[model samples]
Target: MALLARRVRPDDWKPIGVDALEANAMKVVVSTDNRSVIAGPGAGKTELLAQRAAYLLQTGMAPPPRRILAISFKRDAATNLAARVRQRCHRSHAGRLDSMTFDAFAKGLVDRFGQALPERWRPRPDYELMFPNDTAFRGFLFQDVGTPPKAIGSYADLQAISIKTFERSLLVGSPLPVMGWPDPTVGQWAADRFWQSSLHEGKKTFLSFSMIGRLAELLLRVNPIAREALRLTYSHLFMDEFQDTTQIQYDLVRTIFLGTDAVITAVGDNKQQIMRWAMAMDDPFSAFDADFSGKRTPLYNNYRSSPELVRIQHVLAQALDARAVEPVSKTAATIAGESCAIWDFSSPEIEAQRLARFVAAEMKAHALGPRDFVLLVRQKAVDYAAVLEPAFRAAGIPLRNEAGTVGAVMLQELLAEEASELLVKVLRLAMTKRAGRHWTECQEALGALRGISPEDEAAQAIFARELDAEATQLSADHPEPPASKADARTIVDDVLGFVGRERLIAVHPAYAQGGWFEKVVEAAAVHLHGSSAGAADWTEALDTYEGLYAIPLMTIHKSKGLEYHSVIFVGLDDGAWWSFAGDQVEATAGFFVAFTRAKQRVVFTYCAKRGARTKIATLYGLLSKAGVQTIQIA
Candidate 1:
């Protein structure tokens, strides 16, 4: 008789690195039931998910041939979670965990089984992806010729509606009218017409992510074979950033694995639900529990911020939610001096100068690098950049506006693209003289592009040699590194020409197929051109673009899931965050996210001349209640 293998208990698995799994965390990790983990910032949500995945995969709970599907809201989060799991589990076990963005997963399903969709809703094979703005929709309503039909409401009413609102209405085959729509029938008619036109453009189809999701749901709902196949393929499902999930995405999840045997573990903070404008479900935690019969587990310990910083965050938390549970800080204060403060300045110019001085002093005293500090604003980081960039430049410090656009693409988003990453890697390899990890990474990347197996050392060596030859040729072509904006653009173009655009596309076929690869390359060149003004050499320029040596300036929305040693909240006055008065809950959540990003210290800057303080009186009261010191700067 074959001997039964020993079962692995939660206690049997040791924490990797410095990770400390609390008793509750351990229970959640090993539990077989569906779970919804509500964790605050720094609660190690991603780490917990990673540990659970490792536990399930290592113990044969999921077993071979049955993979775990981990869907994250952001590409970077997906990449980070996958990397963490790989670090903890064996290679074979880790390979069974497929981590990808929700959009990517949805699009993959639609791309693969779109033909199975009902003919009435089938998308053409060569459909293009469209991100329609309000103007486009209005134009569609007007046919770009005259006023909209009388059945459709006024222009102001149309402006209030979003594409998601329209898509959601169409998905349910009914008009879930917005608050002020003239008539439900008219709204449905307009949505149907817009959707049909978008899906069946002349000789081409343009489908948004929402449209793709609708088709994915239709494909699964109508085809039991496809649904059963997916159910059998994935025994475990992990949803990260659950708060950011939209109704359509939730519907898709419910349609596929709602009552299936697959175990679902969703982790997110309700307080961090800042994507409501994008049609994120309002009460996803409640919905998850109701739909999947999942147990709710709240993680109250914050492992990121120091005690003082956590205390200040609590003050803001209470303002946002009266019944907010204060999160205990697992991190001790290591840095000496005030952990939280409000710096009030008489004018914007004074605020910028003082901010630069403070940052420089902190860098010297704490031995902090540019990446250790982040400057967050309410919105329009370019406007903040215009004010603060000059001061930082005068202080001999480099400041990069990460929220700024490069050829119509946000710099941060552009950098995260696969095409941009591959080009950066190639550039880094070209600049390196000695063979090290870069050479190996380049070889592995090339091997993946060419479908070469990792075990084939001979093939890898040949690729390595080919990479070396290319690097040598590149170096010979450019004797000196780029020193100016024009030089940087020229070098990037040279790399593209030398590496061949087709070869890069092999590594990033999706972006290529969408015609976004060229746009990404253009944005990369634009970013390099702008970065050249701040960097002294090619290496510095790359570092600046990568947020290595330059201080990052971004909007609060862009700073989610990021941590810094110190944070400066710029323009805390009413004018900068005007929307705070209209929607205090969301605005405060945005502030909460920004405040928690600080590991040791946080500074709030308010310029009296910028805006009146009446609109944000409650925030000031909270700061005072938290015992955060206020300094006056002239």
Candidate 2:
């Protein structure tokens, strides 16, 4: 019964490369029992997780024919961790690990145990996998509903409602017993109906990402053979970003591993539980306490930020009623500069211009590159240009927006309000590092929007002319080309004005109404910010962009597990950054994550008035309450 009963010596068990606290964490990691580690930001949790997987195999804590299943919320993280295990551990031990995203793991289960699945949940052998784009998801939500409910304002609102409903019914296993026309019950019923339609009504069966857990849970709960297969296959289960694990995901994991000899380790900062709507429980480790007899392991050393920045975060965390883990950085003494500050502007436009000048000047003073700096916002608003473009143009800085930069949007989605997104697409194609055939690939993807054939010689000519391919070629040899940003902007405008206007309108009749062309210039700035790569390219692009000369503008969520030389938290006004939705636990946790992303310098910016409303910034008050003083710049 004792898995690690033939315990190795204390020195033999110590991890090869780790500090004191990390060594302590590594011991907890390899334990042949359940563990719940509340690893704060910069606690080296990622490394610890990889080491844990390695230790399980290397120490013989887990025997042969019993693999370790490591799950991450992001596919990239899963892949990265698996790579680390292979590099750090012996070849024989590393081969016993299977690392993948939760969705990927579930899909594998469904594929391997399809015959064991119940009739209601099983899919056809060749069933197609369809992930609905943003446009498609919105269309599905409003499809049969006669009148749009007042409660549902936009795609975002409807998405939140749908996720919460699914969590309550499917994940929590508690269907609200109500038959109201406009309630959580109605939303659940509609979502259930929509899912059923995909299973039975359509000739071609499509299983969405949302269906992965449902099908897996059903199979594990009903089929003994499937459960035994899982138990035999994996003796250890490790989940990263456990804070975001949903109810159905938890159930599936529990069904297969709990009460078995499998050792489970759930590692994440509960304060970073930003996905509360989709999660089954408010506390991330509730199931660990109730279902598994797990010991708590807390990793508190902060390695990413300076001492002053860590102190500031601690104060703010306490005020926000969060888990105030004391952050101590061993290397903090080497980092320099003011750790935090507040900058208040009269209006959003002025704020943008000032931020631009400040960034440009600071870069020169600090001898830092553009990538060392980042601007964090909640989401890309329709009016993102009004506040973002002024600073970019003034500083002559080219940028990349990583959030929601997914290509392959529906053709119908390119008209009227989102004409700017099409311009963004064009700018991305122009800025891409690809040349020749690779460059043609970018054009081919965009060609779908305007009905232009990718291989058409005429369209190619227009693209070459619009992008000023000749000038770019000439400037390529120059060490420092003059007016680089300006030239790029001109090229974007000239090409879009020449070809996009008529071609786009011809495809969508509604575009002929005008006013959309005015947004083309605004959309050009978007190209200055984000990448054209698919959404799955976040981790790789973010890593490359951080080291590149270009600046980054992204949402707080994307900034997780990432650090920068300088981080600017913008748009921190009341009802904006700290909206009612975030007033509680999850949002505060997100704020904590954002504040800790800087190692040397941290800047906080807010506008007094956004449009007509005078704003109240919640972060300022919370920090003030915590006795953290900040130098406010006018």
Candidate 3:
């Protein structure tokens, strides 16, 4: 009868973390302690979280705990694991469970603690044509600070933006960041006011983490009742992506859950700290000993990628460690999969598109389809649409990546500009019968661009801005615009609210039709009757179900604890490309992360002009140690 029982809970069955698992038995002194998980790429940190939570649930303890608190970087991830746990555990055994992203989790706490903080306008605004996102936020950060000292851009741009924004808020005492203020026009006085606010005794010292930390701290430390409840409610707190946490975030988490006896586990990959832009704070796992003043455990096994890939990945990450100037840990990882290779392209324009051509050619020769292929890129810096995507569409092949939404947004940005051009052309074409027909065709081509993404704030904004002009022109020439911008926003926002639910609730909205995507696309089609061509551009950009993809185009920052059959790290150039971190010894550790992502083959390509001072050189160093070949672009 005993032999018939399950050897391990399905939730506890993590093949990945088990491979990279480190028996830091000596490090974790307290039976109940904070376990700082340090590992290389695709090490399966998320999988380990499930395993540990499962162990806590199955055994329940000498006296079983009532619930398990699992936190993650993304709600999508948390929702996935929560559903999996529920499926794995029979109804009777699994305790009450709760999972949340740090943002959602913090918001939940705010409900209890921040009731009195003047949130009159904070009760979830009814957004009409609410904008979803803007590239200005991401691309603007790489902004040039301009001219003499005052005009220059640097990492300080982030700080400067914050300080400037705050000063504007303070000077006018405006409750919110001014909506229409572009960088140059944003109130300079506001920046000074923001700077002064930072000088307040209890205010944050550092600009990077000032907002997130200060907000969380305000509730925890200031609200007496809320503080007491936090201590009791989350006795055993589990935090994922601990590496990206800022100092104030660390302090807030540390302050709430009191006592060393309560178990706290922080799982993170320190080598993957590529968020200099987000002011991502660093917490050394070695310090867990003194901070928790307790035990530390290492989950060394990496079950995500192939062993061959992990070997190279480990070397890459080791090279990044500015601390340990030593060699790769002889402890081989157990990742299993095909090897990785990176080939170079002579033409950036033809690369993604030509890569598409290569893939289509491969598919035709090999009898493959879109399902069997994937395209991964580092920075979607330039508008490569004319390069790769249009090529794929011309071939009638589908592809998925962050490119989908970005492409849609890019099209949306062009709606206004394109419409003005098409209108003038049509008017002129109208004067000339033959040319008028072409102008009419151009108008129809302009209208098809839409956001398959439900809450595409960028597209919605651009569409709304140009809707009036398009409507007036259509009344005089073509049929009236399909729907007014306000109505379109109402319908689209409603639809997106549901689609966003999938992102927010994880698994809740299986039945919401079109979710957010249906509405956004519908809005695009409705808004532009003559512009089916534009619609095609927008529809072509939406990529759903990318998880099934094998290949990935990833940022060095996003590649943490993840691996692939092959990896191609692009956009490597000079001018602050290889700045070593604080710990000189730990510098190469980060390189180990990039190296270990490749299992069997490791190939790197960069602008040769960047020369010896590039990440590729560091790759050369690590590969030489592991006997991996370092080849240049053929």
Between candidates 2 and 3, the one scoring higher on lDDT is: 2
Candidate achieving higher TM-score, 1 or 2? 1
Candidate 2 weakest ten by summed lDDT: 408-417
Q: Scored by Cα lDDT, where does model 3 land?
A: 0.43
Instruction: Report the lDDT tens digits of candidate 1 across residue range 270-363.
Output: 8888888776888899999999999998888899999888888888877766777898899888788899888888888888888888889889
Better candidate number, 1 or 3, judged by lDDT = 1
lDDT of 3 by residue, 1-634 (tens): 1111124543343322233334442232123556665644555555556555545554453123346576766545565556455444432333344666664465455434444433321221111111211243233333422222354333444434543233213222222232212453333433333333332322232221233234455556556677776555554667777666654455566666645345777776676665433445545455554677634445555544555555555555545554522223333443232245444555555445555565566566656545444333344523433355566666656443333333243232222222222333333332233454544343333322232122355764565445434434433542222235454334334333322434422322211221333443443434333232232321211122122222334344344444443444443333224454343333344444555554333445444433344443554555556655433443
Models ranked on TM-score: 1, 2, 3
Provide the clashing-pair count of each candidate structure.
0, 3, 92
| RMSD from true fold, candidate 3 | 14.5
lDDT for position 435 in model 3: 50
Candidate 2, superposed: residue stretches over 4 Å from native: 1-13, 90-92, 128-167, 170-192, 320-323, 333-337, 364-367, 381-390, 393-396, 404-406, 409-547, 581-583, 611-617, 627-634
lDDT of 1: 0.78
Please state every model's RMSD to the true fold in angstroms. Answer: 4.8, 12.6, 14.5
Model 2, residue 393: distance off in Å is 5.5
